[model samples]
Target: MKHVLLATTGESPQVVTETLFALHQEHQPWPDALYLITTSRGQSKAREGLLERGHLARLCDELGVKQPLFDNSHILVVPDANGVPVDDARSLEDHEALANFIMTQVRNLTADPQQSVHASLAGGRKTMTFYLGYAMSLLGRQQDRLSHVLVSKGYESLADFWYPSQQQGQLHDRQGAPLLTAEGKPLIASAATVTLAPIPFVRHRQSLPAILPQTGESVHFRDVVRLINLGEQPEALRLQIDLAQQLITVSDEESDQRFEFKPSLIGLAFYAMMARATCAEESDLTRPSKKRADTALLKVFLDELMPLCGLQSCADWQTGLKQLLDWSELKGQVKDNTIDALNGGIPDYWFDQRKSELRKLFEQKLPLTVSRWLSPEIIWAEDGALLEQPGSTKGGGYGIPLARKNIEIINC
Candidate 1:
């Protein structure tokens, strides 16, 4: 029984939407067993607040995910209340329970005479995804497999990702025709008339920008790492895009004190990894003891960027950056200092200059050109309003549909 493990955790409604979207898109064999582990609160505000509303419940219903019975089959439920907190003293105990849950589920799935297992770790918190993945490594049979869908680019529209159906909409004016130009001469032009079909369950509106975008919110940097691992999903892309947008919104909010600083999503992600890697807590978290130096942060940062930067293809530049970052991490070197500690060693301008240069290089190398890849034409119904039928649950129902209505467009 090739069991595809489609799981989701966190507050982003998009996570579940993307998971279901992927499952349907591939038309892959259905899971023999399924598991979902929800969390109650987290080390970060967004994570903690995710469980606050009826968000999880609504997501499950919208996606048609069955509640888990474990039934020696598959199961789904919240960890502690919704999910176990990483910072909670009970993390070890919670981790054990998670391991057991996975073990039990896998054992049941593979018990049949004609069964094989294949699990896909699509979405969840970092600890949750990591712990679950680690557990799968242990319990997986020789035939059992594990995989994760990574985002090669960012969020994209569903239309671009999926082929559209002509039955869903109609094009009125289809033409390659000659028209009178400014000189009253005929010129070739193209045009089309189209009609849109209904879209359901999508939140079409954009929210107002927050105050103090650059000040940075209480973001769970760890969560960002985990979500990014599930690359290219519309949900994952939106979460990252939303973060970048929020930062801009915050800057808008604190306009009086705002400075012109646009933090690149890739840069911020790399910075977060460095902050966590060099933290004394991480040294303790790992098994084998390794030396912790100020420069260690720079090394960690470079290692993370190497893959994303496609450095292996550019060996000369890769070697140069690696050596420079290595030197920057050395004792008494000021380059490795967190954003707060620049003044005592290298001039503050140098740090900013390096970051600017790095950002430019990345832009040149891997430009944010999702637009160039594919453009999803989301056709909204005649009503500019989004919430379909506020209180109704009929066929046309009430809410906007996730797959097509609030169509997400990601550049490849």
Candidate 2:
């Protein structure tokens, strides 16, 4: 298995060299690959000190260690709320963005089973380290490792000190003052000692259900924590899909709290269909296929979908679904159920698209915890492979964990 070294750094880019120094010279040596996470200013320090000045290369060359695959691409600059790299993480929005970025990075690396990640919590702000640590707890596998590098006390935070080099006789502090020994001899880089401290962290992935983390490019910190901490939600809240107003409403009887917001048309359909099925206490709905058309599936879809049409506020979606299904109009209303299948069926891409987009919508609009509670948990195939079965419980279709009594579909 390829060992990957991932580190979070701040103004002190030396952490990278320190970590490599403490690990690479002897035991476990340099990783097969290396990655760094830092802010805009931090990236500048890393670029200048580690790359431009050739410090990283020099350290490896002198230590007789093979360099790992790394460059500017491996240096991930933490983006701000606007998706722009920020000099520092300070604002509330910046912190949230940082957390999401860190989570995304961690999840992406861990998603690959072939690679074992060695995460270095040796740099960056406390919040950055905390987020990285928590992400490891949530997604880290047995092969994964977490650590923080400890530098000799006097050598810590010294800008000029990347790693101790016996070639240099004197080192300067951040203020540019020469560091010297008690005998008045100039301090050499060899005076610094760096050690790796392995931190034992609880791996929650083994204990929790696989679906809780929401596999994809991004996951919000609040949602994951809430999902893990607040597992098996209480049944006091009811959900509503207001077709007329194009809104999904959540009301709590015990707390007397109500939340209302509009969702994407496709997401609306997928969710509303499931909500309708639950209310009727019907069987699980099968996923739409991308390849061949199944009349039974189309009919079942229209049966729940047609009732949602005929509203002025929902016209935009009406037109979209019309085009999607290649339908000029239904043969009759949802009650008649005689809509003929002019074409084979709608593309299954719509189904997958809805799954991803709908989850994002819920994550963006609903309460952090409530969003996960309302998401459609799909048992997606490994690749583009379509699941052949129909029932949600068996892993081939869509499943909503909510009970029948909790869903209320309001027609236009």
Q: Write the per-residue lDDT of candidate 2 for residues 1-412, one digit (tens) a residue.
A: 8889999999888998888988864486358888999988888888888889988888888888778888899999988888999888778998889898898898888877888999999999898899999889888999999999998867788877888776665898768899876677776788878888999999876554444345575776765554444434637667888877778886666554565667655457667876765566444455655466554545555544555564222234334345434433443322222222324454455556666776666555343455555676542233323333222333344545565577777876
RMSD of each: 27.2, 10.6
Give all TM-scores, in the order shown.
Answer: 0.27, 0.59
The numbered model that scores best in lDDT is 2
- Which residue segments of model 2 deviate by more than 4 Å? 174-177, 182-185, 207-216, 236-412
lDDT assessment of candidate 2: 0.70
Best by TM-score: 2
